[model samples]
Target: MRLRNKPWAKDKLDQYPQYVISGPELLKGKWNGVFDKVQPIHIEIGTGRGRFVTEMAKANPEINYLGIEVQQSVIVTALDRLIEAELPNIKLLNVNAGDVTEFFEKGEVERIYLNFSDPWPKSRHAKRRLTYKTFLKQYEEILINQGEIHFKTDNQGLFEYSLKSFSEYGLLLQYVSLDLHNSNFEGNIMTEYEEKFSKKGHRIFRSEVKYR
Candidate 1:
């Protein structure tokens, strides 16, 4: 779950995220200005190296995209991608996923993407997973009703765990795919991990969960 220790992220991560908001203060009952009037926003948590987020932003100019990555090196790469692509619609933030609610006002996010999030494979580490009950609640407060979460990964255990987590939270799961490339879903945006795993002969897993 820690990207700080990675060599690639160590030398290049930007400590101060541009186009960043600090925390939930923006969305609390007493807040004003910031997130209240922005266009529809979509968030990508753990956007490594910015491949997918950059492409998504390039492809979808009407909607704003925010990508957060804890690894400074990765986020630097993300910034580079944005800069090179000349994508004005995308923003990069270097931060952990745990403080999602702290960063935005309530009902500010329209959708969320948990692309290849860390599995946190150990049982005791369940709380660290992004789809944990607590994180889901955070998402609920920030996401509009029927706000959706789009997740994709090559990890089976994590996918199964997330599936259960989504169900327990009463979020409806649709477009579940145990094998992504095998599925008929079109326009699948593949992240760095997705490309790596897909080439390894591993079947990618994907699912869409919507809050009622």
Candidate 2:
């Protein structure tokens, strides 16, 4: 992942001096300047093309939103959209999801949104799935005590596996819906992949998991 030459890399917006931090060295992390008085921050783990989080930021003025993505290409695309929207409550980060806990302070985030995260369907790649316990533990560290994760995906197997993982990790499965589009749920915002999948008639699986 060389970044010295790419156009997106050269103009990247994430200007943090220490963007990469080790998990063991993150207990004293702080970000008061970037976000003045963290007030109910909502984090979206994989913001592809930035439709969902951006729109959510525009719609909700009180809550701060953070969008994280590892790929420079994707984050660059998302940044372009953010610039277009001129969203003030939104921020961007380019980093691996596995290391998110280290970047955020404890209780800094109030909610998490997992929108169509990579399924990693192969049995051997289960740990790579964002809903796996490994990543949930990372989320737990940064999220407030009662903070909840809102997940939506079109993969049945992954959804079921996620429910099991959430339970195994001691998170309470608060809300579960097999079909999100038809559910009369409120405050629903569909991501880029979600809109396409839903239009194709895929049944979206949704759930909210909180600390039990």
Candidate 3:
């Protein structure tokens, strides 16, 4: 799906510096200082429209949530949700996921969330997938020892590939569900994509992998 460019999105994002952080790299290891309360940090990469992260923040007040999205238009929608939610534990990052390491120091993050990320199905583009080894290595760098990555997707191929990738990277798979909504998993917040796909009878695959 092509994202329509919003010419005024940048200005809107600038207006809410408290919600959408700027120059995140400057904060690096000092992320806790910016939040209302210093707490375990969990980040959602490709946090489209902010549904999952915002809901997560509302559900878990003790943990700070960061929603990262590269596109200004997409993230602007998330900013709107943040503005309405007015949750003190959530912040947004309008930056590329590839540069995540630049904004976080080693062991700065306790958890990472990947939800319905672009599959990048072609073999040549495998490296671009968020679950690819390259990206996993980046996650490993900033994540605390035994930090967990919770991933969800409707694409079976990507799920299978990610399982192999996570295992090969030596992450211990603590949980796996081929059909998440039907499983016993509780408190599962649905992303916009997840809701749409599941309504169409798509099976949502989920996994929890820990870097030990």
Candidate 4:
């Protein structure tokens, strides 16, 4: 679902700096000040439309959740929904995932979520994949030793590639699921994409990757 250019998206986000950090660089290593307390940070990289992250924040009040999305149009919808919820532990970042380190300090994030991310199926575009080794290294820099990545996708090819990428990077795989819906996994949160694909009978793949 490609979004049209919403010229007002940026301004809309600007209206709420507390919920949406417009200039994330200024708050580098100072994210704790935003929430006024030190808490485990969990971010969903590519949080499309904000369904999963918002629900997670509502369900888990103790952990701070950040939803990072490059598209302002997409995030605009999320901001509207989050503001209505008035959640204190959730914030949205209108920044690219590649520059994630510039916003959070090392060992600052406890969990990273990659839900229904772009597969970047082209052979030449492998580097753009979020689970690519390069991106994994970037995540490694911010995630604590015990931190883990929770990833799910409707694309089997991407799932296989991510599994191999994680293994090659010396990360341990836990709770790997080939059919998430039938696996009866506890605490499973469905993204908008996940629900759409699953209803069409697409098998949802999921995995948890952590430092070895």
Who wins the TM-score comparison?
A: 3
- lDDT, ranked from best to worst: 3, 4, 1, 2
lDDT of 4 at 31: 79
Ranked by TM-score from best down, the candidates are 3, 4, 2, 1
TM-score list, all predictions: 0.86, 0.87, 0.99, 0.96
The top-ranked prediction according to lDDT is 3
- Model 4 root mean square deviation, Cα atoms: 1.1
* Cα misplacement distance, residue 210 of candidate 2 (Å): 0.6
**Scored by CA lDDT, what does every candidate get?**
0.80, 0.79, 0.96, 0.90
How many angstroms is residue 73 displaced in model 4 relative to the true structure, after the best TM-score fit?
A: 0.7
What is the clash count of model 4? 0
Candidate 2 segments whose C-alpha is farther than 4 A from its true place: 1-9, 12-28
lDDT of 4 by residue, 105-156 (tens): 8888999999998999999999999999889988998888868999999999
Per-residue lDDT tens digits for candidate 3, residues 7-31, read 9999999999999999999999999
lDDT digits (tens) for residues 97-182 of candidate 2: 78676678888888999999989999999989998877888888888898899999999999999999998999988899999888
Badly placed stretches (over 4 Å) of model 3 are none
| Candidate 2 backbone overlaps, count | 0
Q: Candidate 4: lDDT over CA atoms?
A: 0.90
Kindly report which residue stretches of model 4 are placed more than 4 angstroms away from their true locations once superposed.
none
